[model samples]
Target: MEKPRTIPSVFTPQWLPLGSLVLLLVTLALALTGCAAEKKWQYLPATRGEERSIYVIAHGWHAGIALPAEELGDELGFVREYLRPGRYYEFGWGEAEFYQADKITPAIFLKAVFWKNPSVMHVFSMPAEPAQQFPGADMVELKLSATGVKHLKDSLRTSFKLDAAHRPHPLKGGAHGEYRFFTAQGYYLITHTCNTWTAKVLASGGVPMDTVFTLRSGGVMRQAKDARKEYLKLRPDRAEQEGMQ
Candidate 1:
């Protein structure tokens, strides 16, 4: 005689964790869809040639854009005061208090996600050779054409909410005074999170990214790496020129 084992019911206590995980994922998906439903301007492909290298850096829950200090345009003059000529500038935007917090607690994270709060741009000034700065961190190097560079700089320029003097004022030192926070436009939202911002910035820079559901650092970095690959395919010669090999 043979007996068949009955399947466990999903309502059982043992399945509660699995059910909860599915519910969480569904809720996040719905939230991302609702928040990203806003209209976005379609971008044309970047122009051929005149490529410049930029980086997408991942710091666990956060992501940032890193570029040559020379690309720091006049519009973001405030960011220059923190670094010298031979430096790399990395920018990230997020909820002011939560982003600057040295240690994140459950309560702080909950408030940042559930509440609407002012945003701040955190600029990290690293050595010109940023390769070693974030040694253990995930980084992707992407090339942007002239048109893409312009779009990227424009995004950076417009992120700051200038004071009455028409300039972003530095707020305070962040991350053990290694970086500085500056006043920025827009509010940090659960759906339009820091990772979302990173994806949007890359999209503006002619990276083929769908910013809608890019609400996590891993996804943002993954898209950036893919974009780099696509850019290289269009101009394999430039990869050699840039010493990316």
Candidate 2:
């Protein structure tokens, strides 16, 4: 008989595999937890007062006029579902550092948009730093008429006070109160201020109004603006004879 045969521990082989599996599971769990923790929180812009709010109106290729801001908010649901096709709404507040003072300026902004067939419309408020000062908000309604684009264009000029000639050119891009028509797409972007840095992207891609508003309030306006410009460039040209300049 040989010397007693040496035997390995009965649990040793199983223990290593089991331990490895458990380690792998724990690593995966920790990674997932880390990812969840890293997710960011989205915030809505604040409103100045109950009476003062921003409203955006979109009619499927039709023409319309501005209404009071409060009235617009109350009827937003009806306008979004019945008057337009896809609906997006958003509101929020933001704060910017004051260069001269030790204080911060609180700003509020709102946005809405709708899509119907060949037409898409967007409504956004002027981003007001120290928003409390602006007691009144503007309500802008844009209609894209598939049948008569010219009539819609004229209405925008007359009703919204959009003047391509007198529009103020921002230091870099277009101008304030300047409404430019993309004769190719039959789409126009009108802004009261340069705050439009992101409005263009949201309107073109049909991004929900809420997402755009939230992004802007978070100081990601540049990203939003770039997205809009890229999307608009890729869209089809507006129907010829669709409207007037």
Candidate 3:
């Protein structure tokens, strides 16, 4: 009897070396240019708050929150020790590989979405005001009660993943000298992005936020705009500062 021919299994292991050039030009288009083509809000100067305030800042496809470093309670000294002395602290969470990569690639992005990748919390020390530190970013200034501040800080502490020794796991230095990326508590998924994390952080402090659909930086900023209007409505002085009736 003639032996049966075995089907080749090697064909299944595709060489991802040619993900785009081989096929799916339109899919490649969506993967490559979609992020850049999305709308990005420009930075607008907000009248500085005389009291405690939180800033929701959007930088292109990412979103982060800013708070005065000195204002944080001693409970956050774990994070503070890793950062440089600065006026403001900006914190955000994202996929480890994609966030730290000097350049984001389609493979990196797809893997982040498809795989259960580890997350990271990026803390950047800003020497000046957030507006000055990131001239091109979009910002929304929010004023909160003492309770709100406490809740927000507590939520921030929750983002950092503690080690067996009860300390935040330091990953690597940021692209600049003033930043540190620590191992974070959550996994990055297709639906839950860095912007989603910002939404969750803002919502924890009782900000008027809708986190469900805030998958993009643009969406997070739209909610920020809404929060600004809502907070201004409550403060006649701030409304007047904005020249609002």
TM-score of every prediction relative to native? 0.77, 0.20, 0.76
Candidate 3 per-residue C-alpha lDDT over 73-161 given as tens digits, one digit per residue, 9 for 90 to 100: 76466776787777788788988888877655668756865688889988877778876766666788877766676777888889989
Candidate 2 per-residue lDDT over residues 209-230, each given as its tens digit: 2222222112223233333333
Q: Report the Cα lDDT for candidate 3.
A: 0.69
Which residue runs does candidate 3 get wrong by more than 4 Å? 1-51
The segments of candidate 2 whose C-alpha lies over 4 angstroms from its true place after superposition are 1-91, 94-205, 208-219, 238-245
Root-mean-square deviation of Cα positions for candidate 1 versus the true structure, in angstroms: 12.0
RMSD of each: 12.0, 27.1, 13.9
Per-residue accuracy of model 1 over 1-245 as CA lDDT, tens digit each: 11211211110112234455546744784556323323332343444446577898887667789888778766565677654433678888988877766655556656776789889888876664556776667889876776777888889878888777777778877434446788888999877888788888888887777687888777787767766666556666656766754
Worst 10-residue stretch by lDDT in candidate 1? 4-13
lDDT of 2: 0.24
Residue 66 displacement (Å), model 2: 12
| Cand. 1 Cα-lDDT | 0.69
List ranges where model 1 is wrong by over 4 Å: 1-49, 83-86, 174-177, 238-244
